[model samples]
Target: MLQPKLKSKVRCTDRDIGEVTKVILDPLSHEISHIVVSMNGSGERQIEMAQVQDVMEDRVELRAPASAIAALPLFQRHDYVTTHEVEISHLEDNIDVTPGEVLVPFPDLEKDVKRRTFFMNFTHVIAFLIGLPMAYPILRFLMKPMYMPFDNDWLMVGNVSKIKQDDVGVQFQYMKKVKEAYMPEAEVEKSVWVLKASPEVLDKVYQDKDQEFRDASGRIIWINKKDFPYIAFSGKCPHLGCAFKWRQHKTLGQVFLCPCHLSIYDATGSVLDGPAPRALDALPIRVSAGGDVEIIDMEFKAGVKSQIRII
Candidate 1:
């Protein structure tokens, strides 16, 4: 029968206090004993049931004078669960709270964000410290494919019929595929001159008095025109790696000539004139039964007579 509603107006004998914010109940008896009144739209004050002279549907009448009502000890409902709240409460009950008695405090975003950033930076530093020593081995492993035997690196050149019989020493460029661990296969492009030639050219004109081009295995490994109809010669000059063109000279016919130093090679890639140290290098080529022309893309040391590995 004595249920009180929130926002019910409360009045002292001389002046109005504002409204009932919450009804205060005795904890042990579970009975409403006092009304919480707000003053000046800010602080809260409580009124005892003994001070309420009359209670109506919309308002409460107090027996105490306005000065006495204002003089009653200030009351602040325990609004905050943290001691860091902007407004500190001055109630005697609030002071007696032990560390174990309080509820969980609300989360603060600024403090949480700072804490997370600190941990993230710490983890990044730890990871870098753990990863630094592995860099050299990783780099060596990544570069190993580039150091693979170039003479054995077979790469696609073109179709077997890509060359026309009438065309004299036609030249083209092609990409050679290089594969490595943990990386996408990469393409390496080089210039090539594809033509039909007799394999005996190496033994006849190119082989020196000492067979300097011959490897220690007694096999003419660099001379690849033996079994295939199509032969490809590296378009790089042995002088200094400058690109050479198949040019029709007034006297020399179609010869591989380097513009950088006037070095020249005949159709069989044998050295003809200029300061070239060795004949043009032959790339090992194969014609598949299906007619796909493939060559082992390789690089050789320039400015030297014998074939040497560059990559």
Candidate 2:
């Protein structure tokens, strides 16, 4: 039995011409009659079994020359015909079977290819649908902080009525809701130094001083439209963000003192001495209808001369 495999090298008497692509067989006698050789740069050609001299393990030797093989006619595969009317021997000899053509011997090859293609396409769609729901929540969670509104809401600090006129500075603690990046909103305990002074005393302290309320980028965030007798100063010292307290200084009388750096601020929150670059930060405050003191909780960059709001 002379059986030639596909992809076996087809060599002419002169040199190698091409490779075997198809084995054309005589269906009635179950014998190989012709071989389709795919030539390099020349397309495919059908060679008769009479021109095949030897069929080796990896090559098929032809009895023709390279020039003769090149001169042979190009192979052509005909259309399909019904097996019930056409003879198998005549069909194999006259017509060739190309890709996508259904062969009578292997009827399931074309159907299997189509079924596999449909299954692969359907699998990709199902995988995308399953992954969409899983990806949406993760994307939203990561992007939520960028879309959340800025924290500028006014919070009640203390009652203005309770602060005595002689009070140099009173520290009032309050709970502020803060939302940091990727973290849940939390209530943080914050304190502010509330100073209750008369109009004459306020003028004497802040008379020639220019207090510009600005953010870290130098953009004005708020302006003191109305000057009230009560002033709310951030508990953070203007030098290094250290907590300052009200105490009786040996020379300055009642003053706010930062124990960390000895920065001193008198009853008006003005920098009196030490390495303090500027005055204490004054927060936006308002006297409510019910005599309650409301303030916009804020923070500012430390160590700089300008009052730069941090939050």
Candidate 3:
């Protein structure tokens, strides 16, 4: 009986040639016919069993010289076919087995199945490793807003003495610290329009004394006490959130105008003309005894009648 081991060194008569990579067997007889040897530098070749002198535990000695084996044809793998798919004429005559006994003549088929399984598992592992790094940044960026705190703290914007009753609207720019997940804390410039109005003017703009500003979920966001003389409006317009300017119009006189659209507002931040959905958004204000104006800077959803706080 000849037992050929894969990866066994193949030694020619002159020198060591290569190693055995595969053993080809006769399907019916279950006997070895050819062995595929992988050469060190010349690639793989098929060697016939007739040239094999002896098969040992770890090596196979050949009767031919190194030059003769080097000239052999290269080994090629054939496509597999199942026994039930093809008809063999002499399969029964060659086998002398008892009745109701099955014979499995192919051992290399199990090795091929195992190789494919290992390849698939290796591919999945590599794919997971590559995808993990790419997905981390996107997940962090999306969840950053959830972990951030809302800007509800009062920030000192300007002095009340500078905003006079004669002025239509005064623009006050202040530096605010912004928080970002991927970057360090940085200061950004923010601005708001301040208007000084009388008691009658404020009452006309805010008609409903019980009117309340709420968010999208119907939760009350803010309610004016009508105590402060200085009214501060958000720089963003309600119609599409464009920056509005306090300008002198030819027909409308002193009004807040948005250059993007023709949305206009009066000194009380009430929508006077154009496509503005509602009055300009207002923020909570506080006046110190020393005349310092502190206001809570906030943002709201645009193009809606309701005042929905965004941040």
Candidate 4:
């Protein structure tokens, strides 16, 4: 019988490993530190890390080892590159090499660089001369984090004593000051009537929880739970801007009625009669310490069922 042949280590080039399976298995016995795969300028594929495995004459059956894929430098791919100092740890197979570690070129990158060489050269000079000077100030102003003051922070109101709980119609003025120039008056105040809900009326509103309101300027309003006591919607009928008012009905007793076009709305600002397109608008309210009232803002006007309003 012939003596059994012992497995011997062999050296090969990337071109020798003809098939993909042999390429993947070449570094099975020896741990694979890195994998280098890139293309050349002529669109030629180069496998730098698999140089030893590539030159194999026949397929070698083996398992794959863990490895890290790395990109090689440009000069290496153009001309033949050499690893000056390769320190491979025999125990762990971790490799540490000099500057010219691997040479795997990517043709796409080479093409892109070649195409934009003219523009890139000019851009680099311009950026170095101009953009670098302004970069520091721009970054400091826009990117730097700044601290904000908390003096204007207000807390949400929770409890208050209820005094008058009846549906009493209330109206307040929302004044906007405008500066007058060539005239004698320095400033003038434009006052707009803002409606508010009474205690009893607000109670019914809380029960129904409707959230629609609007102003004469076709601006819709909404209410928030803050420092408001009661909400008041614009009692104006949108059909013809008629003021919708409330009155005692003959049979319904305390029913709201609009005198302008015979339009009628309920105590909760809902349209009860007439050709009104929607119910009364909703105003926002916040409560005070003693259950007294103040209007933080108004909830814009809206039609019934639909969220569309004259915001």
- Using lDDT, give the best candidate's number: 3
Candidate 4 residue lDDT tens string, 66-122: 121113232234432222222322322232222343322233444566659988998
lDDT of each: 0.66, 0.75, 0.76, 0.40
- Cα lDDT of candidate 3 equals 0.76
TM-score of each: 0.44, 0.49, 0.51, 0.33
- Can you write out model 3's per-residue Cα lDDT over 61-167, one digit (the tens) per residue? 99999999889877555432223333442443443222122123345655487789999999999998999899999888889876665666789998988876653
Query: Model 2 — which ten-residue stretch has the worst lDDT?
Result: 99-108
Backbone clash tally (model 1): 0
lDDT of 3 at 36: 75
Per-residue lDDT over 9-117 for candidate 1, one digit per residue giving the tens place of the 0 to 100 score:
8888888877776655443343456776777665677777788888777788888887777776677544323332422223213222232222222335534666899
lDDT tens string, model 2, 1-311? 34566788999999999898776655556455678899987988888889999988788999999999999888764422234334444544444344222123333354376788998999999998999899999989889776664456678887876677564788889998787986788998899988777776567555745344554445766555434667788989989999989988888888899999999988777789999999888887777789888787888889999866567
Instruction: Give the candidates in order of lDDT, highest first.
Output: 3, 2, 1, 4
Off by over 4 Å in 3: 1-144, 180-183, 208-223
Report residue 250 deviation for candidate 1 (angstroms).
1.0
Q: C-alpha displacement of 76 in model 4, angstroms?
A: 73
TM-score of 2: 0.49
Q: Which ten residues in a row are the worst by lDDT in model 4? A: 1-10
Best candidate, TM-score: 3
